[model samples]
Target: MHDAPLMLCAGEALTDMIYQGDERWVSRVGGSVWNVARALAVLGERTAFAGAISRDRFGDALWAASEAVGLDLRLLQRVERSPLLAIVEQGEPPRYFFIGDDSADLHFDPDVLPEYWSRDLRWAHFGGISLAREPLASNLVALAEKLKEQGVAISYDPNYRNLMDERYAPTLRSMAELADVIKVSDDDLRGLFPGVPLDEALRQLRAAAPSAFCLLTRGGQGASLFHGDQRADARAPAVAVVDTVGAGDASVAGLLHSLARHPGRSLQSHLHAALAAGSAACLQSGATPPPPAAMQQLFELLEGDAS
Candidate 1:
């Protein structure tokens, strides 16, 4: 058994219809939280995913993939429906088309939270379509509040999709209030705070979630960390780009892994590790995270560069 830090990820778990050139599509198990959970597990973190999955074959394959990646499935709920599928397109900034209507993932119920699920978890993460959908949105928000009350560190990634209602602003604000850490991409910031300048966006986010440590990601450039009066930014090492699907989630996992392993390390250390992890994911073709060895190698390189 590896001595890995315990993490709880709550949100959507589904399949991705990846565009493989001209009009060709391939199915791959993916979801924002799923990608984050998989990345953490692959990096040797003790991880558990909480979501309602379908009873169909796609759901079974998702469970198998989770198990194979070492993610605990005790909190997974099964429904008799089908899972969500996202049609992904390749471009400068990849676009996604979600083909889910009342999918099982949207049916996640807080009442079904297992008794052993919350205990021992040091960190909990939730966001993406999970926060934008129905019943699950409310359920996930309640879960985050409970976790915060239990003194567990909470992280949020608003992997926003356009399907969300315009009225979702309040929900986003509320979630930001409860999170101990918040991760957002430049696109997310623009979408959430339309017309707001970058600096003002960060300032407003900090004002909204006063206690939360915020990280703003810039796709190919790298990421920025904002905490108290301290701020750190790093540019990702230039690498051959393969796919950008889960790079943001990979960055979240990397940041969490660094914080869990070296609690109270300088902000620069966290940013450096996160950039490395995210850059490594770009070297792969799918949403699956890079191996632990790859993460370790990048960490070493970052450390060397810092020294």
Candidate 2:
């Protein structure tokens, strides 16, 4: 395993309103990249989060949660505005409703990045609504460019929120070119590429970003990994799903953790680990990530079964 920090997540930090069976709702700190960062931390990987949060109670909760999960918060910023919020709906196909505008997350300024932070990270992750918003989107793109120039591995998950304007596609595509690894859900790919077939969409995306290792996640079906001239697919194990929230983020974290722990492992093994992490997330409620031991056990079992 590489001793270097495995991941750096840069994006929005917000709260999610989760329905608790009854008419009541509970507030939980969540954001795509934030969830992934927390998952990575729980798996005993060195991880840091770089994003803007409000000075409000919600932001405090987010910070506390991040700290609890052992994610480095030196790069997190606090602003006067309130953080973003999302309402999650549970059904056959889960849905999300983003609430709030012009919040702290959209105000991220690249100049605020700490000068002392090392650029030698193994992976830097950015995406979600942060890639769909204004100054934050531009700021992340700039940061990704800088990280790429320094030869740092970049991971991106365009966790596309419907709240974003459709006009952001150009900017999203432009930033996609800078990522070394790109993770996307089937829903996100459909939204980004519209009526194109999955393979055709991937072909177009690969052409736009030739060097990226692409991962296409298909919810319960499984996920596929594409790198160089190779492609590998792994089926997600069946589990009693409590909520699908944060599943994709968990998968991203798992992929990063596996890569960090077993650097030269095959692509199939990496995809298997990611599937296990995501499946574990489905077994939990709210945006809470699965425990480290659970993730490891899932990976071991899946690998054994595959072998």
Candidate 3:
């Protein structure tokens, strides 16, 4: 509401039904862009989860979680539609399915978002299953293009899912072309570019967005940042990782927030902040917004290693 800078993470906000054991499952409010928006706001950015949720129990939880993280509610939309959900069968590697048809997410009306929201916007992020769906996906793609033309910085993370097979390659390329920053895990690379060698896929992805600051995260192995002809890599500072749930989201948030906050910082410094934030998220369970104190401690550790 104030004239402070705003960032929009435009995508789905869903209820994650994570299976525990023997028919037990716990519900959590999650989605790629939702997590990014929450992580950014948690890191003190004036952020908005630019999507819609059903006016149901799932929506209720998501609404509260957004507020708890200090997100600007004006950019949030609630509709009288079915709630979107990610039904997860957690395992060594989780398998999941989306359970929403024409849900509230698909009904998000960008036209109704706060007037002049774009005026102070610093960055606009896109990705998640929201980009793999219709009407909504098309609308989001158009929105990203519009914002880019308006000179707003754009960031993207495909957060690849089964839904985004070869059909998503074009969207990937186009969005990457417009991105000022992009985040992709190695796993995401494999999934998004199926049948291609990982290295080759990454090469092609980079070619699509040659000027964008590309953050390539390799889970606990750490991350790499590509800028023009230069590359920066950092080993993830060790942590007793409790859950990697939102680590990628947290890392992307860290990198983008740092880039927005300190555009003059070295790429290595930004990468360290991202790795620190990702590790910080791992210290907690169930995609909790990480504590700033924890992030700083880990960030210092990473900085020490570099020095």
Candidate 4:
């Protein structure tokens, strides 16, 4: 819509209230899909964030961050609803809870997006607790299905949260089957399918979307890819982690960035790039996506070592 190719990330964007000692808490802008959008934009991709944020102070922070990241603000919605907040009420071990019902993110109206946006969209990304969050989740599923019919690619990552209980199973399977690319971490596999072994959970996922490119991230253990019957594995580069807040978001964005920017390259190489970007994200604190230089440096380290 804005001349260059467009990529949309449709999901939640909320404020993260981190405990800062006795009685202080600091707020920061964060949301899984939003993080991916920022990472994609930082990688020079024409990205749009299609989520709704409130007009309040918390929403102001998110709006400013999105604008600073060069996102196409035209597709971003500003609403009068309350902002969603993830409060890390405890510092150590990070015990947190959400604060908001009928928030701005749930008020996102897909019909209001730019007309014919799907025609130019390289891909549309969906996932995060937003998928587990009720009426909004249904809205996104319907949107994704329509976009699929229009021939636009779809990417999904169900960054599982405690909120995703029994009600989330259907959405999980539906999104897995609908996405062109689906990413799930080892932890997600366990959380999403309790009591199911890791391999069994993955098998179930493959059965749901056997043709989709499946990315399996195992944190420090590395990552693997499955497409058809062929599988590829790549080990992650060890880095001093400041915090793993946005690492998975960076990894997924890194994979997409490589695929979009390096057509015809091997999927194995792309996986390595993802690991590098994820490692880069850990070098910094909070939910920030790595700049191109940091990602490229780790990418080179990975590519060079592999070669």
Per-model CA lDDT versus the true structure: 0.84, 0.81, 0.88, 0.88
| Ordered list by lDDT, greatest first | 4, 3, 1, 2
Q: What are the models' TM-scores? A: 0.94, 0.92, 0.97, 0.96
What lDDT score is found at residue 178 in candidate 1? Answer: 86
Runs in model 4 deviating more than 4 A are: 91-94
Question: What is the alpha-carbon lDDT of model 2 when measured against the actual structure?
Answer: 0.81
| Model 1 regions more than 4 Å off | 1-5, 89-95
lDDT tens string, model 3, 1-307?
Answer: 4664478899999999989899898898899899998999989898877899999899999999999888988878999999998899865676888888879999999999877777888799999889988889888999999999998899999999888977777788788898988889999988987788988988999898888899998875778999988899988888888988898899988888789888998889999988888889999998877777898898889888888
Candidate 3 matches the true fold with a TM-score of 0.97
Could you tell which candidate, 2 or 4, scores higher by TM-score?
4
Q: Report the alpha-carbon TM-score of model 2 versus the true structure.
A: 0.92
State the number of backbone clashes in model 3: 0
- Candidate 3: C-alpha RMSD to true structure equals 1.2
For model 2, residues 1-307, the per-residue Cα lDDT tens digits are 2333547889888888877787988888888888988988888878889888899889889989999988887778888886798887754466767776788888777786667474557789888888877777888888888887877888888876675556877866776788777888888877777788877877887776776778889876788988888889888887788888789999988887877788799999989888888888887886778777777778888888889
| TM-score for predicted model 4 compared with the true structure | 0.96
Best by the TM-score measure = 3
lDDT of 4 by residue, 90-150 (tens): 7565588898788999899988877766677778999998898878899999999998998
True-vs-predicted CA distance for residue 40, candidate 2, Å:
0.9
